[model samples]
Target: MTDTFVALSDPTRRLLLDRLSEQGGLTLSELSEDLPMTRQAVAKHLAVLESAELVASERDGRCKRHYLNPMPLAKMAKRWLVRFEDVPLGSLSGFHAAPAIRPAHHP
Candidate 1:
């Protein structure tokens, strides 16, 4: 979706998504702890990701824990990237396998 691409355009948001993928159900404070920006700034990035359905949150007691929602990204890849999967680009300089971009086997 357009929102997903928009949300992924920012490196910060991508980093946030990466963190969530690495550790799901993290509080905003935990998510922002290692970042150089204030918690509010991180929250703003999270807001955009949430708008794009790239992130989901749930209230747990007094804390709202954030999680990475990969479905939007998988849908996007299925829509756009699947077409290029069989293309041979090995001759291109520096081309290599990117595990991060590869979808996991579901079956």
Candidate 2:
């Protein structure tokens, strides 16, 4: 879980995940294109994501293709984020709406 958070902490890793989400099965070279960083830098980011189980890669002949594995993120959301959806924000004191006031008119 910590690994997942750590992997998500970096903007570059998040961008890599977004790219993979948009199009799965992309090679390191394909993922590196259009980015300011070098291929090796992207690979390092991918490595962190892979360690968190957020990215999965498979070798295709001579090249390795990377894909997004959303399970870890889903699991994290289910564990923490889902609970927020169940409880309405209005029910929470901090989120509760203040009473509307009416202006008094002078005769």
Candidate 3:
């Protein structure tokens, strides 16, 4: 989705998604802790991610928790890299295994 790519294009937003992937989910305050920005700023970033459908939120008691939605990401990758299925360009598993983009698998 265009929104998904637009949201992931930002480093801060990427960091937010990384945090969610690492921690499963986090509150707005929790997500802001190690970042240089204030919680409000992080919340703004979260808003963008949410709008992009890269993240979703729900209330856990008094706090609002945010979590990553990986499906859209996979869809984007498929749309961008799938090519012609009949052509056999191989799969993402093999593609991501390449040395050039392999480091992306590291934390």
Candidate 4:
């Protein structure tokens, strides 16, 4: 979805998602520990990701644990990338029906 793409466009958000993917179910504090931004900034980015449905959170006693929701990403990839998957790489390279060539000898 467009929202997902937009959310994924930000490097901070992308890093957050990567962190979630590497270790799912992390709290805001946990996610903010190693980041250059403040916890509030991280939370704002997480909010964007949440709005895009790329991340989900559940209350864990005193805090909420955010986890990566990969369904939307998977759907996007399948919709946009799968079509090109069937096309051969050679065709994309404009080498259709071309034979490999060796370098000519120089005088």
Candidate 5:
């Protein structure tokens, strides 16, 4: 969905997603330490990602660790993106192979 794409378009957010994907999960502090932004800013970004359902977090003892929630994206892609791939074979190339006797409206 547009929300997921918009959330992922930011370099900082993408990096956060990558970190969560690679490491499974990370506390806000862990993610903020290596980045240039403040902890608050990271939380703000995470908030957007959370609303988009692109990320999820859980409180672990005293720390809230963020994790990648890819199911929404997987479902969205299956509904929105895969349809393009399933289009009838020649649909895209139809214009290029127009018949020699063109239809009145086509010419």
Candidate 6:
């Protein structure tokens, strides 16, 4: 869980995840293209994501293609968000209690 958070803490890693999400099973070269970082740097970020189990890779002939594994994120979100599900919708909405009334004074 901590690893997942840590991996997501870096913007580069999050971008990589977004790329994978948009188009799964992408090679490192495919991912690195148009990104500010180099191919090696992208690979390093992918490694962290892989360690956190947020991404998975499969051998594609000569290269490995990376894919987003959303299960861990889904599980974490469920754990964190499920507790709030029971709360009243009105509380979450813009339904604040009324303020106390005060008498208007003439200037």
Q: Please report, in order, the local distance difference test score of every candidate based on alpha carbons.
A: 0.93, 0.94, 0.86, 0.95, 0.87, 0.93
Clashing pairs in 4: none
RMSD of each: 12.5, 4.6, 10.0, 4.3, 7.3, 5.0
Where does model 1 exceed 4 Å of error? 89-107
Query: Which pairs clash (backbone N, Cα, C closer than 3 Å) in model 3?
Result: none
Model 6: how far residue 82 lies from native, Å: 2.3
Q: What tens digits encode model 2's per-residue C-alpha lDDT throughout 22-94?
A: 9999999999999999999999999999999999999999999999999999999999898889687778666
Per-residue alpha-carbon lDDT of candidate 4 for residues 4-103, written as tens digits (9 for 90 to 100): 9999999999999999999999999999998898999999999999999999999989999999999999999999999898897776765667678989
lDDT, candidate 6, residue 12? 92
Which ten residues in a row are the worst by lDDT in model 6? 89-98
- Candidate 4 lDDT at 80 equals 91
Number of clashing pairs per prediction, in order: 0, 0, 0, 0, 0, 0
Clashing pairs in 2: none
RMSD to native, candidate 5: 7.3
Q: Candidate 3, after superposition: displacement of residue 22 in Å? A: 1.0
Q: For candidate 5, give the lDDT.
A: 0.87
Look at candidate 6 and give me any clashing residue pairs. none
Report how far residue 100 has shifted in candidate 6, in Å.
16
Candidate 4 ranges with C-alpha deviation above 4 Å = 89-107
What lDDT score is found at residue 18 in candidate 6? 94
Model 3 residue-pair collision total: 0
User: Which segments of candidate 5 are over 4 A away from where they belong?
Assistant: 84-107
* lDDT measured at residue 86 in model 1 versus the true structure, 0 to 100: 84
User: By TM-score, is 1 or 4 better?
Assistant: 4
Candidate 4 least-lDDT 10 residues:
89-98
